[model samples]
Structures are given as structure tokens and as C-alpha cells.
Target chain A: MNIFNYELKINLKSSLYYLLGMIALTSLYLTFFPSFSKDTSAFINLLEGFPPEFQNAFGIDLKNILSIMGFYAFILFYILLISSIQGMNLGVSILSKEERDKTADFLMTKPVTRSKILISKLGASITIVLITNLLFYLVSYMSINLIIEDTFSFKVFTLLHLSVFLVEMIFLSIGFFIGVFLKKVKSTISISLAVVFSFFAIGAFAVNASDDKMRYLTPFKYFDTNYILKNGTYELSYLVVGIVLIILCLVGSYFIYVNKDIDSV
Target chain B: MASNIIEMKNLTKYYGKARGIIDITFNIKEGEIFGFIGPNGAGKSTTIRTLLNLIHPTSGESTIFGLDTTKYPAKIAEEVGYIPSEIFYYDNMKVKELLKYSASFYKKDSKKRMAELVDIMELDVNRKIRDLSLGNKKKVSIIQGLMHEPRLVILDEPTSGLDPLMQQRFFDLIMEENKKGTTVLFSSHILNEVQKISTRVGIVKEGKLIKLEDMNTLREKTYKRVLIESSTPIDDNYFNIKGTKDFKTVDDKLSFLYSGDINLLTNKLSTLKVHDLLIEDPDLEDIFMHYYVREE
Candidate 1:
């Protein structure tokens, strides 16, 4: 419990900063919505002038560019990219910092099992993601309602925001697993940025745009906003894939971390 | 009978293909300060890390407090305090906050003991960890290690960054804890420092335990560092005899470490026309060299 509380205390400040950054970004993007909605066709024609791949790359949906929820969905792409970075940074740093800083000997020699330490760190991460998602949901909901007058589907809006949290979970798990597997991590942000950008790029250039199987490749493509708008629910297979990926990453991390030799040399 | 507090049976570790420790076996008594002595890269840290369960042995069994270290490290750690050679803590944390976090690991209320250690170490608790010097960080490690008042304290080259005055105070503090029946495992490469504290000593070389002897017996052994200035340059092999090692000659001065019968050494020395002679007990460096030269 002490370990859990200590980890939470350390992570709390940075996570709040991430939340504030997201809120600021969402507000800034939504302010432009009132004016952007005025001339949707002109903007859509401007975007339509680009190649199909380019349009897909930027997540420009011509059909729903006028509605407030659709505009928010476009904004969610950037949020997903940013929060994934935040999640990856948190996961990588929380577990690997002790080794990076050469403090593993101090913490490992204490009267706590390795499993307990890992669990405490994992729990703190979950709590951070949970708190961030909740506050983000509340903030986005109120701000969107206040900024735009056009009626939009509440369910689709909720699902769009929910996808951000889901993607963050997968990235966090991947970061955690990488944290345990690597012997030395010189900089957490470098690893986080490198990984998140790679996935973002993979999702940007879809191998087969029509193929559902390609969605499993990158977490960024898992929840299609177009699909969410049309069906009002997530792709079940992608949700299962995300959960399974998270479990595999975390469980693999646990086993490797427990038996790992914390070599000082 | 003083039951063994730590026991190892053929403990060996290999980092991939490189050797860490090889067939090292020894026991530390319940209340004795066991000095683990060896040169750098000689597996002193490896052995200590195995005992602390920081690394698993490649093959072997070790028990601390009569509990299997691999299976019951947490239980063993409850009564053990360890100060690593390299001290590190959260960079953003204040000294007081880090110490309190460390104190929270144990079940005991260490507030009073923490206060006393802070006073004795003369540490400024308000200082951030990143702002402190190496010596100050070491003081933090010492205080945190002892705050819980654990039964067995293991120190690995703990005096490197400490000043002479602080080192003396640290030894005095360890002795005080020893008087209260806290067993200590002090590991160092320096001979005199370990000699000053350890009741028994174990010497390791090339990942192997070469010798384990009582501190008094090891001190009282026949080993002596002999230095002589001869009137004329003597033959190089003239002093070579049983249990003599590291023989070297510079101009007319001859030096060697001898652990043979004192009478034989004296009888040979009487034949030499010596201008100046000095015989002193061998320090750990010379003694370690003596063991290394003998086995090959």
C-alpha cells in the first residue's frame, strides 16, 4: 500500500499536466469550430482537392466536417497521438527509473517482494489513466456543449473519447513491457516518442484501407470514427485485440521483471 | 554455539559466459562482523548480491536467517539492512522525503531512529537529492539503512565517499550497533578498513573463496612484508624459498612477502650483509597477491 501510494504521489503531478494540456488543446480546437462550420463546403472542397491517401492520412472526413461531433472526432486524432505519448512516457518511466538511476539495489533490498513493487507501479498507472479519462470526459462534454449549438449524437461523442483512453491503455502496456525487457533506458521520452510516432505513421499509411485485418496492426486505427458515427458502437474484434494485447504485454512484463537480475554493473 | 546467520553451498553465478562467482562457499556466524575482502572484479559484490537476492545464483543454495534466499528474500530482508556502494534516490525529492519513503518500507516505526541518525550524520533534510554531493548522498544511504535497526547490516565499500571524521563516526556507529547484537557483513577492497572492524575475514580471488580465517588468526599468521637494503646487489633467487612471493629487486633494495617459518626466514637473512631491514605485517593487497601467486 505504501509503494502504491508513493508511486501515485510521484505520478500525480505529471498526469495532471497532461490532462491540462489536453483540455487546453480541446478548447483551442473547439473555438475554431464556430467559424469552421460556417463554410464547410469551401473547406471540404479544399481538402477534397488533395489525394485520397493524403485525406486519410490527415483523418479528414468530408461527410461529417460540418457537425460539432464530427469536428471533435477530427480533433480526437491529435489527442490520441498526444495522450499515447503521455501514456507511454508514464509507463516507461515509472518502472524503469529505479534501474536507470541505479537505485534498484536500494528498493530491491527492502522487505517487499518484486511482484508487489511491479503491481504497485502498475496500479498507479491504471489510476492515472482512469483519472485522466474521467476528467477529460467531463471537461470535453461540458466544453463541447457550451461551444457548439448544433445537436450531435451523445453516444458517438462518448465512444470517440473512450477510444482515446483505450488506445492509451495499449500504449501504456506496450511501454511497460518494453520498460522491463530493456536492460538500460537512457531517456524515457525518446523511447516513448519513437514508439508512438512509429505506430502513428503505420496507422497513417494504411496497408489495405478496406481490410479490417489491417486495423489490428496499429492501435491508432482500432476505433474508426466513421464506423463509430455510422454504427454507434466499437468494432468488437478491435476491442478484444486491445484487451488481449494489454494482457499479454503486462503479463510478460510481470514474469520477466520478477526473475530479472538487477545487475549493477 | 553461534548458529550461522548466513550459509552458502557451492554458490556460483555466470553472467552469460562470463564468471561472476565460482563455487564460493562460506558461513557467517550470528553476531560476528564478517569482512568480505577481494579486489575489484573479484566477485565480492557478486557474492553479496547473491546473498541479498539482487541476482540469482547460476547454481547453488544460500540461506539467510535460515531461510532460502531465493524463495524467502522478502522475509529475510525484513531483518536485514543493506547499503549499496552506489547511492541513488529520487532526484526531485527532498532528503527528508526520500528518507521517510525508505522508512515506510519496514513495518517498524523508525521516526525516532531516523531523527537520531539525521543528527549523527549532520544531514540537512531540507536539501534536494539532486543538489547534494556524493558524500552527502552516502550519508543518506547510511541513515536510511540503519533507520529500521535491522538485525543484519551489509555494507559494500561504504566508506569510499566519506571523509575521515565521518568514517570514524560511521565505524563508531557500526560498533555501537554491534554491541547491541547486530551482525554486519562489511565488504571492502581496502585491507586496513576491513581489518579494523571484521572479527572474521574471507578473501576471494577470481570468483573463488581462497581463504576464510579468524581476524586474529589471519593477523597472527606468519606472513610478513620484508624489505632489505643490501651492501651489494644480491642474487635474484637468493631469497626465493618456501612461501615467498612477489619477489622484486630495485638497485640494492629487495622486497618480498614471506609466510613461511619465521626461523628459516631469519636464518637466511643472517647470511646477508644488510644495511637496512624492515619487516611489517602484510596488508590485504600484498596478502591477496600472495594467494594469487601461490595458486598458479
Candidate 2:
């Protein structure tokens, strides 16, 4: 318990920095877009002026751009983009750093089990991502409340942030899986980026495609920002699927880490 | 009731198809300083890693404190302190921070232990690990390994970066630890250092334990160089003594590598017109080279 807390303490600073940076960037972007905080019709008009292909590529829908929920549609996709990269960097670097630095041998010689060491690292990574997402939520909420004077549903804002949090956790879990399977640090980072981007591309295509079947194929399509904007809620089935995938990925990571041949210092 | 702290029975390790170590078997008694001596790529590190349970053995078994290495690795690790040949710490961590992080694993007064080790090793804890010199970094590694005062200390090439004075100081520390009943297992290619502290020496070559014996016994059994200056050219047949392994004749001098009783060498020399004879006792280097060359 003390060791785990010690590990957490060491990582807390980096986690806070990442969180604060994300919040700062998001706030700056929101503050710059004056139309987004002012007239909803102007925001909708601005989104509609873009080419349909461009809007689809960015996972933005012009139809719901005027609604209170439409703001969430824009924010969710952007949050996923930032959070996935952050999560992947944190996960892929954790264990591989020990090997890259030639400290695995020394750490392995301690009385702790492999599982225990991994658990502590995993716990730290998760805690960091969660704290970052929480800060993002708080910052986004305050920005929306302070900047937008018009009446907007607070429930939509809550649901949007909650869905984003779930998506971030899923990416974090996938990143953990990547870390366990890859040996070299460079390869791990590269593979994690490829996997995350591929998923994002698949999700974008699924959202834009005319075929209804394509929607089920991508996790991103499940949390349709357009649907969330119109209904003020996330799709329950998609939420369940995302939760299941996260659990499976986490379990797979543990299995790989437990049996894999760990190199010494 | 043998006080064996470690025992290996025909242990072997393979990295894919390449053999890392083959059929290595040895035992180290409690409080003994056992030196694992070998040349580069001789599988010294492989055997040490296997004993520490850092890598799994391909065959046979190893037990530390009578507990199976694989089955009870955590238990064994709790009592064992390990110093790797190449010591590396996180780049951004201060020396003091790294020590504190490592010390957190053991149930001990980490701060007090850290202070004592810092004093003994004469290391600056405030400096970032990346900023330290190779010798200073190595000192930090040594301090981390010994701070917990484990029952068994496993150090691979522990004094590689230390200067002669520091090496002597390290020897003194090891001797002092041994006096307090700590079993030290150190591997090194430097034969002289191994000979200075080791009670028993295990010579590894080509992934095998070619020689394991008491340090004194190995010293006694190793081939002695006999350089003889003869009044008359001695016949090549005179060099074919029973214990001699290799014989070389140069001008008036005949040199024979004697692996047997010195008495037999003396008798052989008595038969020749030996004006002057020099018998050089084999040091660890000679013993290591003899076996390594013979194996090759």
C-alpha cells in the first residue's frame, strides 16, 4: 500500500501537468470561438458552410449545430483525440521505461511480485487519466457556464462529459494492453499511436457512412454526438459495449504481463 | 545440516536455441564469499540471472535458502540484494529520490539506512542520477543493494567503475559484512579481485561450470610455470613430465606448465643440468586462462 502510494505520488505531478495543459488549451479554443458562446444560429450557420465531407471527416454534424447538445457534439470528438494520445503515452511508457533505463533487474529483485508491481503502475496510470478527465470536465463546465449567457440544458452538459470520460477510460485500457504486448519502447509508442488513430478513422467512417451496419462496427459511432444532442442521452447499448471492451482489454493486459518473459537490468 | 545458502542442480538456460548456460551446478555455504569468474560471453551473467529468478531456467532447478527459486522467488528476493553489472537509474530522478523509491520496497527504516549508505559510499544524494559519473552512479547502486542488509548479496561486476582506492574500500566493506554473516556472491572477469575476497571460486566457460572448488584448492591445482635454464640443451623427452600439460623450449630455457605435484616437477628438473629454475605459482588469471584455453 505504501509503495503504491509512493508510486502514485511520483506520477501525480506529470498527471496534473497533462490535465492542466489540456484544460488550458480547451479553454483557449472555446474562448476564441465567440460565435460558439453567442448565437446558436450563427454557430449552426458556420458549421453548415463547411463541405459535407469535411464535416464528416471531423465527426461533426451540421444538423444539430444549433442545439445546446450540439456544443457537446463538437467537444466529445476533440476530447477523445486529446485524451487517447495522453493515455497512450502514459501507458506505453510506464513499464518500458524500467526496461529502457535498465532498472527492471533491480526492481525484480525486490520482494514484490510481478503482478503487484504492474498493479501499482496501472493504478497510477488510471488515476492520472481520471484526474485529467475530471479537470477537463470542470474546466469545460465553467467555461460553458461563464461564456454562454443563453439558456442551455445542464443535463446535456453532464451527459456529454460523462460519455467523454468513458471513452477516455477505454483508450487508457487499450493503451495498457499495448504496453504489455510490446517490448521496445519506440515500437510500443508507435504501435499505440497507430492503433488509436486507426480506431478513430474507423469510427469517423462509421459515423459518415450511409449503411446502418457500419455504426455497430466502431466504438466512436456508438456515442453519436448528433444523437446525444437531439436526445440529451447516450445510447445505452453503446455504453455497455464500450465498458465490455475496456474490461476485456484490461484483462488481456494482465494476462500478457503475468506470463511474458521479463528482461533483467 | 550443511549450511548451503544456495544450491543448483544441473541448471540450464536457453535463449531460443542458443544455450545461455548448460548443466551448471554449485553450492555456496552461508557467510561465504563465492566468486563467479569468467571471461566475456562465458555465461556468468546468465547463471547469476537464473539464480536471482530474473530469467527462468530451461532445465533443472535452483534453490536459495533451501527454497525453490521459481516457486518462491518473492520469498528469496526478500532476503537477497542484487547489484547488476551495468547500473542504470531513471534519468530525471535525483540520487536521493531513487534511493528512497528503492528503499520503499523493503520493510526497514529507509531514511536511516539511506543516510548510512550515503556516508559509507561517499555519494552525493542531491545530484540527478544522469549527472553522476560512472563511479558515483555505481556507488549509488551499491548503496541501494546493501542498504537493506539482506542475508545474500548478489553483485555482478560490482567494482567495475570504482577506482583502486574505492575498490579496496569496497573489499573492506564486503569483508566487514561477511564478518556479520552475510553471504556474498560476486561475479567478475577481474581474477585478482575475485581471488582477494572469495572463499570459493566457480569458473564458467562456454555455458558450463568447468571448475568449482575452494579458492585455495584452485590455486594449488592450477598449472605452475616452470622456467628452467639448463647448462646443456635438455632433450624434449625431459619435458614430458606426467603432470605437465604444455611444454615449450626456447634456446637454453625449457618452460613446462606443471598441473601436478611440485615434487614431480622438481624430480624431472633434477635429471637435467639445470643452472637456474623458476617456479611461478599460478594466480587466478593463470587458472582462468588455462581452463579457458584448454576448453577452446
Candidate 3:
């Protein structure tokens, strides 16, 4: 348990700079918007003049263009991008990093089982993902409160943020699974990026193309911001699917990492 | 009592269809320094990997400290310290952090052990492992392997990157560990180092244990280079003596490898009034070459 905490501490310390950088970027984009005032006719006319395909690509509905909820939808893309990057970086590097660094032999030489070592690393990685998402949520919430109108429901806001976290966890676990299959660090990073961005692309295309049934194919589509905003609730089916995928990926990662042949120091 | 600290009974490993190691059998007594000496691609690393359960053997059985390697690898790992040929550490981690993380597995007093090892290996605990030289990284690896005070220590090419001074220090460290009843099994291509430390040595060749014996016995049984100066030119037929190979002939002098009964050759030479005779004991490298050439 102490070892798990130590591992977590090390991960958190290493991730702090990246977390701060993401938050800084998020805050800069949210606070320094080119058009901030809601009553400007110029902004309203510009929104009206945008193509429907462009609006759909950005998850902007026709009715909610001038509303604070719509702005939240625009910022959500950046949030998902940042969260996925963090998740993948943390997840893919956790166990395989030992192998990449040639430190597996040094670690294995100790009086511990492979299962225990793996569990500790997994625990640390999950904690990093959770902490990063939570930090992003908190920063975004504060920014939204200060910059956007008060009409935004805290409950719906929480649901949207929680959905983003779930999607991140799913992607993170997938990255963890990739780490077991890929040994080289560069390959692990490339594969992780490819996987996360590919899912994002699929979900974006499915939503923009108005293919409701196929939206379930991509995890990002599972968190429907407009549905959550309108109904004041998350989709149960999507939540369940996300949870199941996360569990499967995590279990698969553990099985593969434990049995894989590791070169020692 | 545990019969052997380490044992392998006809162990074999295959990487796909290629044999990694084949029919290797040996045992190391408790607290003895056992040397695994071999040339490149001779299966030394494969055999060590099998013993540590890093890779599963295709056939045969291995045990460390009386526990089956495959069946109870975690248990065996708990008692054995392993230093692999190549050492790599997480780039983001400092040396201290790396060592701490490594020591966490053993469920021991890691802090004290880490401090002691840092002092012994003269390592900079604060530097990130990526920034350290290969020798320093090897020192860090040595510290990690020894910190837990395991019952058995297994090192592959343990002194490859170290300077002569550090290598001597490492030898001293191994000696100290052996004195405290820790069994040491090390593989090296450097025959002199093996000869200095190993109570018994196993010579591996082409994935086979070509020779296994006490160091003294191996030294005694190895061939001697015989140089002869004949009163008259010796017959070329004399070169056909058993165990004589790589025979070279000059005007009145002859040179050949001699591994068999020396008395018969000397007696045969005495009839021609031997002018001068010189015999030199073969070193481990010579013995190794002899076996390889003979096999070919």
C-alpha cells in the first residue's frame, strides 16, 4: 500500500507540469475569447452566417448558438483533447516504461511478485488519470462560473464533466492495454495517440453525419452534451458501455502484462 | 538441507524453431561462486533467463534454493537477485527514485538498504538515470540487486562497463556477499575474472555445456602446448599422435596441441636425443578454442 502511494506520488509530481500547462491553455482560450459579450449583434450575425456543417463539426446546434450552454459545448472539445492526451500518456507509460527503460530486471530482482508490481503501477496510473481529469474539471468549472452566465445548472455541468472523465478513463485503459502489446516507448506513444484520435474522429463524424445508431461505435459519442443539457441527466446505456469497456481493457492489460516476457537490467 | 542453491536438469529453451539453449545441466552448492563462461551465442544468457523464469524453458526443470523455477517463480524471485546484461531505467526518474521503487518490491527496510548501497556503489542518488554514464547506471543496477540481501545473486556480464577499479570493488562486494552465505552465479566472457572468483566453472559452447568442473580440475585437465627441437628431423608420422591437432612443422622443430598422455610423446622423442623441449599449460581461452575447433 505504501509502495502504491509512493508510485502515485511520483506520477503526480511528474504530471504536475503537464497538468498546469493544460489548465493554462484551457484558461487562456476560455478567458480571452474574441467575442465575449452575449448581446453583440455582430457576434449573433456571424454565428448565423456559419455553415450548418461547420456548426455541426463544432457540436453547435442552431437554437443554442447565443446561449452559455453552446459555448460550453465548444470548450468541451478542448477538454476532451487535453484529457485524452493526459490519459494516454500516463496509461501507456506506466508498466511498459519499466521495460522501455531496461529497469524490469532491477525491479524483478527484488522479493516481489509480478502481480504486485503490476498492480501498484496500475493503481498509480489510474490515480494520475483521475487526478488530472478532476483538476481539469475544477479549473473548467471555475472558468465557466466566472465567464459564463449563471443560468447553467451545476447538476448538468457536473454530469458533462463526469462524462468527459468516463471517456478519458476508457481511453486511458485502452492505452494501458496497448502498452502490453507494444514494447518500445515511441511505438507505445504513437499507437496510443492513433487510437485516441481515431476514436475521436469516428465519434465526430458519426455525430456530424447524424448517424445516431453508429455513434455508439466511438466512446466520445457516448457523452452527448446536448442530451445532458436538455434532459438534465446522462444516458444510462452509454455510461454502462463506457464502464464495461474500461473494465475489459483494464483486465486485458493486467493479464497481458503479467504473462509477457520481460527483459531485465 | 537444501541440496543445491541452484539446479538445472537437462534444461532446454527454444525461441521459435531456433534453440536458445539445449540440454544444460549443472548445480551450484550453497554459498559457492559459480561461473557460467561462454562465447557469444553460446546460450549463457538463455540458461540464466531460464533459471530466473524470465523466459519459460521448452523442456527440463530448474530449481533455485529448492523451489521449482517455473512452478514458483515468484517464490524463487523473492530469494534471488538478478542483474541482466542490459540495464535501462525510466528516463523521468532520478536514481534515488528508481532505487526506491525497485526496493519496494522486496517488502524490506528499503531506506536503510538504499543508503548503504548508495555509499557502497558511490552513486549520485539525485541524478536522473538517463543522465548517468553506463558505468554509473550499472552501479545503480548493482545496488538495486544487492540492496535486498537476497539469498542468491545472478549477474550476466556484471562487470562489462565498469573501470578496473570499480570492477575490483564489485568483486570485493561479491566476495563479501558470498562470505555472508549468499550463493553467486555470474556469467562472463572474461575468463580471468571467472577463474579468479568461481569455485566451479561451466563452459558453454554452441548451446551446450561442453565442460563443467571445479576450477582447479579444469585447469589441470586442460591441454598444454608442446614445443620440440629434435636432434634429427622428426618424422611427419609423429604428428599423428592422439589428441594432437593444429600441428605445425619447421626444419628441425615441431609444435602441436597435446592433451593426452605426455609421457608417451616424450618417450618417443627421447630416442632421437631431444635437444630442447618446452611445454606451456593452456589458459581457459585456449581450452575453449580447443573444444570449439574439435567440435568443428
Candidate 4:
């Protein structure tokens, strides 16, 4: 509990920066939607002018482009991108920071087991991610409500927000696995960005491929915003896969960390 | 009866193909300060780290307080305090915060003891860890390791960054802890430092513990550095005595290492026109070299 509290205190400021960045970007993007709807046809024609591959890759869905929720789905692409980076950055840095900062000897020599340390750090990171997603949901929902007089389905709106959390969880788990898997990672941000963007690039390719098998390769494809907007629910199969991956990564990390030989700095 | 506080039985560790320590075995009795002495890369840190359970052994086992170290490290750690050679803490935390966090690991309330150590070490608790110098950080390490008042204390090259005055104070602190039945396992390549505090010493070289003996016994068996200033030019063969090696002469001065009978050297010196004679105990490095050369 002391370690948990300490972790929370140490991470609080950085987590706030991520939240603020998300809020500012999401709110700024939502404000542009009111004007974007006024010129909806022009925007649609302009989107249509691009190659079909480019449109599909960028998630430019003309059918839902005019509506507020549809506009949010378009904006969800960027939101999820930023959210995943934040989650990945948090997951990668938390566990490895003790070693990278050369404080492992101090912490490891204490009476607590390595598993307890991992749990505290993981718990603190999840709490930060949870807080970020909750604030992002409120800010996005409020901004959308203020801009559009036409009512949107509250259920669909919630489903969209929930997918962001789900996607962030996947990235966070993968980031954690990477952190534990490597002997050392000098720069957590660079590693996080590279990993998150690689998966995102895979998602872009999966968009064009639209292959059922390829969707499993990328977390971005796991929560299809279009599918969520239509069915008002997450795909059960992908949700199960996401949960399984998270469990596997976390469990593997615990085993590796507990059994690891903490070499001197 | 004093029990073995620590026992390593045929313990071995290999980092892939590189050797850490091999077939190492020793025991430290309760309330004794056992010095671990070795030059750089002599596996002193490896053996200490294995005992602390920071690194697992490749084969065999080690136990502290009669409990297997690998299986019950956290349990063992409750009564053990370890200070590594290089000290590092969370840079963002103040000294007091880090000390409090360390204290939380123990079931015992260490607030009073923590305050006492802070005052003894003359540490400013309000300062951030990053703002501290190397020696100050080491002072924090010392306090944190001792604040818990653990039954077993392990220190590795603990005096490196300290000034002579602080080192003396630190030794006094350890001696105080030892008086309370704390068993200390002190490791260092600095021979004289260990000689000052240790009751017994273990010498390691090239991944093996080569010698373990009582401190007095080791001192008895080691050589003395002898320097003689003569009134006459000394003959090269004049002092060709047994157990004398590395003999050298420059003008009217002569110096050599002597390990044999003190009476025989004194008799030979009396016959010569000796102006002045000085004999001193050789440093640990010389004694260590003697052991290595003897082994080879």
C-alpha cells in the first residue's frame, strides 16, 4: 500500500499532463465539427475525391460524416491514437523506471516481494489510465452536446467512449510486456511511440485489407467504431481476445520479474 | 552456542557462459563481522549478491538464519539489511520520504531509530536525493540499512565514497550494531579497511574463495615490508636470507619483504653497519599477492 501510494504520487503529475493534452485536443477537435457540418456536402465531395484506399485508410466514412456521432467516430481515430500512446508510455516506463533509474537495489532489497512491487506499479498505472479515459469521455460528450442540437443515441455515445478504454488497455498490456521482456530500455517514450505507431500502421493496412484475420493483428481494428456505432455493443470475440492478451502479458511479467536476477548497476 | 547466521554450500552461478562464482562455500557465525576481500571482478559482489538473493544460484544453495535464501528471500529480508557498493534512490524523493518508505517494509516502528541515525549521520532529511553528492547519498544508504536494526547486515565496498572521518564514524556505528548481536558480512577490495574491523576475513580470486582465516592468524602469516638504511654499501648476498623476496638496493638504502623469523633478520641487521631500520606490516594487496602467487 505504501508502494502503491508512492507510485501514484510520483505518476500523478505526468498523468495529468496526458489528461490535459487529451482534453485540449478532443475539445478542440469537437468544436470544429459545428462548422464542419455546415459544409458537410463540400467535405463529403472532397473526401470522395481522394483515392478509395486513402479514404478507407483514414476512416473517412461518408455515410456518417454529417452526424455528430459520425463526426466523433472520425475524430475517435485520433483520440484512440493519442490515448494508446499515453497508455503505452505509462506501461513501459513504470516497471522499467526502477532499473533505468538505478534504484532497483534499494527497492529489491526491501522485505516486499517483486510480485507486490509489480502489482502496485500496475495498479497505479491502471488507475491513471482509468482517470484519463473518464475525463476524456466527459469532455468529449459535453463538447458534442454543446455543439449539436440534434439528439444522438446516448447508448452509442457511451459505447464509443468504452472502446477507447478497451483499446488503451490492449496497448497498455503490450507496453507492459515489452517493458518486462527487454533486459533494458533506455528511452521509454521512443519505444512506446515506435510500438504504438507500428500497431497503428498495421491497423491502417488492415483497414485496406479488411481481412478478418488481419484484424486480430492490430488492436486498432479490435474496436471498430463503425461497428460499435451500428450495433451499440462491442464485438464479443475481439473483447475476449483483448482480455486474454492483457492477462497473458501481465501474468508473464509477474513470473519474469519475480524470478529475475537483479544485476548491480 | 552461536549458530551459523549464513551458510553457502557449493553455491555456483554462471551468467550464460561467464562465471560469476563457482563452488563457493563458507559460513558466518552470529555476532561476527566476516570480511569478504577481493580485487576487482574477484566475485566478491557476486557471492554477496547471491547471499542477499538478488541473484539466484545456478546450483547448490545458501541459507540465512537457517532458511533457504532462494525460497524465502522476502522472509529473510525482513531481518536483513543490505547496502550495495553503488548507492541510488528515487531522485524525486526527499531523504526523509525515502527513509520512511524503506522503514515501511519492516514490521517494527523505526521512527525513533531513523531520527537517531539522521542526527548521527548529520544528514539533512529535507534535501532531494538528486541534489545530494555521492558521499551524502552513501550516508542515506547507511542510515536506511541500519534504521531497521536488522539482525543481519551486509555491506559491499561501503566506505568508498566516505572521508576518513565519516568512515571512522561509520565503523563505529557498525561496531555498535555488532555489539547488539548483528552479524555483518562486509566486502571490500580495500584490505586495510577490512583489517580494521573484521574478526575473520575471506579472500576471493577469479570466481573462487581462496582463503578464509581468522584476522589475527592472517596477520601472523603475512609478510612485513622492511626498509633498512645502512652506514656502509650493503653486499647483494649479505641479506640473502630465507623467506625474503623482492629485495632491492639503491645506494646505501635497502628494502625487501620479509616473512621468516624476526630473530634471524634482527641478527643479520646487527652484524651490518645499520644506520636505521624500519619494519611495517605489508598492506592487504601484498598479502593477497602472496596467496595468489603461492596458489599458482
Complex DockQ, candidate 1? 0.76
lDDT tens string, model 2, A51-80? Answer: 887898786666665444575557567767
The models' CA-based lDDT, in order, is: 0.90, 0.79, 0.78, 0.88
Candidate 4 segments exceeding 4 Å error: B227-234, B248-255, B260-283, B292-296
TM-score of chain B of each: 0.86, 0.80, 0.80, 0.89
Question: Highest lDDT: which candidate?
Answer: 1
lDDT of 4 by residue, A1-265 (tens): 9888888888878878887887787778778887878887887888889998887778788888788888888888888898899889888888888888888888888998888999999999898888888887887788778867779999988998888898898888888888876556689999999999999899889888846778888889898888887888899998898889889988988888888898778
| Tens digits of lDDT, candidate 1, B5-120 | 99999999999999999999999988899999988999999999999899999999999989999999999998898988988888999999999889888999999999999999
Which stretches of candidate 2 lie above 4 Å from their native place? A32-46, A187-191, A212-218, B110-113, B224-244, B248-296
Please write out the lDDT profile of model 3 over residues B157-275, one tens digit for every residue. Answer: 99988999999999999999999999999899877788878999898988999877788986565677888887786778866877787678787788877887878877777678678
Better of 1 and 2 by lDDT: 1
Q: Could you tell me how far off, in angstroms, the CA of residue B274 lies in candidate 4 after the best superposition?
A: 9.8
1 versus 2: better TM-score goes to? 1
lDDT of 4 by residue, B147-252 (tens): 9899999999999899999999999999999999999999999877898999999989889988888999877767888999988778888878988987878888
Error of 2 at A205 (Å): 2.0
What is the C-alpha lDDT profile of model 2 across B1-296, one tens digit per residue?
54999999999999999879999988999999999988778899999888877788999999999999988888888778888888887778899888888887887666776687789888888999999999998898888888888899998999988999998998998898889999999899887789899999888888998887788976666677788898887877866767786677888988767887678777766778878888876555566666555665
Query: Which has the better lDDT: candidate 2, or candidate 4?
Result: 4
Residue pairs in collision within model 3: A101-B88, A101-B89, A102-B88, A105-A264, A265-B84
Task: Provide DockQ values for all models, in the order shown.
Answer: 0.76, 0.55, 0.49, 0.78
